[model samples]
Target: MENQTKVTEFILVGFPSHPGSQLLLSVLSSTMYAVTVIGNACMIFIIRTDSKLHTPMYFFLENLSILDICYSSVITPKAALTFSLGKRIISYNDCASQMFFFSLFGTTEAFFLAVMAYDRFTAVCNPLLYKIIMNKRLCVFMVVGSYLSGCINCTIQTGFTFSLSFCGSKEINHFFCDVPAVMYTSCSDTLVNEIVMLALCGSIIVGTALVVFISYGYIIITIVRMPSAESRLKAFSTCSSHMLSVCLFFGTVFFMYAQPGATSSPNKSKAISILYTIVIPMLNPFIYTLRNKEVKESLKKKFKKKGVFFVPLLRMRMTTVSN
Candidate 1:
């Protein structure tokens, strides 16, 4: 205890160092944040308004988009503000809260993505059972399960991190209060926490990755075995976007968490984190909308209707004014 350093808060040094970087970082991050919200919102709205997207695939996609929005919101804006103000101080309690939510959302995403893979598998491999297998109740339950897993993971990770005493210098090496980064600052023994992290977080990442791989593996086989060329092509197309999203989201995740601390680079982690948090979400809507003919047609119909409805109203107003 004598040598223990009491830390009230921790400083988060975010992004590369540069003069007036705060202003630049703030503007850039703010734009990204805005786009994330709008993009995800549009996705949710399109999925909702467009009856054609009323399938299990789109249902899960809507939830995934929403999660990405929140996942980005939890850390990006705060980090941006810190960069903008050139202040990186985060209180102990706030830091723990951030870590908790971040872990929760992230863990939930892993499970959700796994669920999506399974959905794709059923849609491809068991076309007849797709309806029964992915019913409304089942979809709702899956979403709930993802949230529950996230909550439990958050509780465990946050509880573990907070239990340790932080009687030391509070300068965190990373932009966020990631579990490993926080653990490094603790004066108390963190072996248990680290082990839990490796076991729980690692398992979630690896387990989800395994599920996705297996599902896609089976799907590819099923697609190839199909007698009709058209059916095979359509099936592959349907799942291609989901597969791409999965690879991007979880690939960086596994790469970041799977590595040992000795070899992990702060710069690498930050860059990969940016990919998942900023770039991936921005890319999803484009992937789905562009690849899926139904989504494109739906958008066209929605806009066309708006244009037709508004044009008549404008004409009526002009005629009444002239009379």
Candidate 2:
């Protein structure tokens, strides 16, 4: 404990070696970070501004966009700075804060995804009672519940992590202060930490994933029983985008955290982390918009109303002609 107090900061050894590679990575990371912020911001703006999108689905989507923005911001900017400006040191308190927020947002995202799955189930599986089931009060509760659960979970995880005495080197092998990487530096026995991680974190990740899968299973059954092909297609389209996002998020997360630590190569883990932390957020807006005709139409109407339509159309035409 005394030695732990002596340590004031930790060196974040982000993306190990190759200065040239780091520069390239910085450029790419910065570009993705900008896209993530802008794309999610647009989603939020469109959902809020569009009266037609006031349904439960879009409401949950707006929340998801907000989460994506927050979750990515917690890690990406600092990582981009590390790659670009070579600032690799993080204060002990700052590191703990980062871990707490990261875990909070991450856990919230998982629960929110589960709630979104429930929303979809209500919408598709019980269309007649969708409004009654997912009323404003319930929606608000779900969102608030996600945040509260995140706060509780992160508090425990962060407290448990920081309570352990860290000795030897303070070098974290990843771009950000993830639990596994942080624990690796501790001189104290981490069996309890690992067990807690397996029990608490695993329950959150796996439990939410099961909810999503079970919801989708019922959704598929309901969609198949629809009277018309058009209805079936509409139902599938609505859920497909969400399902893809879920798969991308849960797949990468489960890969990183579900297994025992230090078994996978650090570089591989870093690459996976990049996918979930940066690429997924940036891609989510595109995935939801490109696949959903309603969002695209809403966007077109918004842009045309604002007299910004011509620019996007002109760019599209230029790209088409070039191709």
Candidate 3:
């Protein structure tokens, strides 16, 4: 490894070939990034200001929105740049930093989703004790604990990855500094690195997925036992949005990282990455708000308060007077 020169920088081969496709993709990527930021920001703002949404469920949702924004930012900007400017050169330190934050926010998102599932479980299976169990302190503790755990995981993974001697190829065949992509460029043995990555990341992904599955299992049983159709429907409605979110997030993640070996093409991986990083963040706000009755009501009340609903009516009356 010492015989080969150490790589100080990496050139990312982001979406190679097809100039027309790249241009279109750039436009789409930029649009998605804007939507992701604004949508998540609106969710956070709405939840914070709406007193009615001050429950453990919304609290965790707000945390998830924030995480979506953060995790998307770590990957989307570089991807967008690749499309727009075709500038894919990244410094070694910058690559490491990107990987660190990506891991941190990504891991945090996984845990937060698990916590949200638990919140839903409590709300459905034990409604009477939901407020008592998911108190403010516990909520704060869960959020803080997720971040702390992410930091520790990121530290271990990033330290091990960068410690290797990267000698041969500095050109990564992906948009951003993904762990596997970077590892592929190393001249030194990546057996331990790959093993460690699989162990840590697999645990986080599989563990959270199991928790969500179990929570939903209990929720399903509880809903089925309800005597009335209305009661079951109402209970299921509360969980539908969360279930969609969990499926979208975890499905793409598992496909991208949790596979036994790399069977898919790099282009397929990139497409999946775009789905999880760009599309999912933008979709979260719409999914929760459009599907949620409380959120819709809150939005209507907010718009009504600001005279958004009445402005058109007033304008019509003024036009009639002028005529």
Candidate 4:
């Protein structure tokens, strides 16, 4: 026990050296990390300052941006700097902290995405009662519930994960300390840990996914029943951005954690993990901004109010002609 505890750090494996892959990973990781922070931060700023965006939809979006800022900050900073360090080492406790926050924010984002979907349903299918149903108190409650759920999941999984003896290879076969990657280093039995992780993570992913799908199912039905073509188009447009965000995030996350205990190549795992951990955060601002007329309008209003070069902005702003 003393010797195991004395082992304080683990080596993180970078990509195999193949024609500048390491440099590429570093550059790509750094770029994405920067974009994720700036983009999400700007989104939060936009949402906060825009009174027009204080509604439930933008409220949920603000929370989602906050989550994006969080989970990515925990993981991306280290991953971005991996190649710069000669040793590529991380302390044992730090690894556990990283895993804990990553899981917490990731799980919270999952639940919150489901909540966003339901918000959309209420907006589209029950517009008259939307405000009354999705009141401020309820929004706060759902947001708190998602965070509390994530806290519980993180505490349980992180505790179970680090409890196992990790006296084997201190080398983790990935750029960061992920659950599956860290589990690979444990010398003691991880079967139960793996089972717990799978059960909890799978439940969160699958269960929240069902909520999103079911909500969208009703949304689709409602849209279909609408008489006018323009109304149907507008209604579908309202949900499109959320659906895209959902597909990108849930697909990558499901691929990563849904099959815990299953053996796969470290490189394969790392490649897929990048999509959610790195790529999604960077894309989210664009996803919610470019096609979103309201966000663009808000940006226009903001820029116009600040008197920050409005002519070029006016030219670019017309591109998002849809809702």
What are the lDDT figures for the candidates, one per model? 0.84, 0.90, 0.87, 0.87
TM per candidate comes to 0.91, 0.93, 0.93, 0.92
Instruction: Name the candidate, 1 or 3, with the larger TM-score value.
Output: 3
Worst 10 residues of 3 by lDDT: 258-267
Residue 85 in candidate 3, Cα distance off native in Å = 1.0
Kindly report which residue pairs in candidate 1 clash with one another. 5-167, 5-168
Residue 244, candidate 1: C-alpha displacement in angstroms: 0.9
Task: Spell out the clash pairs found in candidate 4.
Answer: none
Per-residue lDDT over 107-168 for candidate 2, one digit per residue giving the tens place of the 0 to 100 score: 99999999999999999998999999999999999999999999998999899889988778
What digit string (tens of lDDT, one per residue) describes model 3 on residues 1-323? 46333567899998887878888888998899899999889899999999999999999999889898999889888888888788889998899999999989988988998999999999999999988999999999999999998999899988888888876778887899887777777778888887888778888899999999999999999999999999899888889888999999999988766765432366677778788878988899999988788988988888888897689889999999999
* Ten-residue stretch with the least lDDT total in model 1: 258-267
Instruction: Give per-residue CA lDDT, model 1, range 1-323, as digits (tens).
Output: 34332555788877757857668878877788888888888889999998889999999999988998888888888878787877788987789889988888889989998999999999899989999989999999999999999999899989888788877667777778887777776778887877787778788889988999999999999999999999988888888988898899888887766555612366677767778767777777888888777788888998999999999999999999999
Q: Candidate 3 — which residues are off by over 4 angstroms? A: 1-5, 262-265, 308-323
lDDT of 4 by residue, 89-174 (tens): 99988999998999899999999999999999999999999999999999999999999999999899888878878776889888
- Model 4 residue runs over 4 Å out of place are 306-323
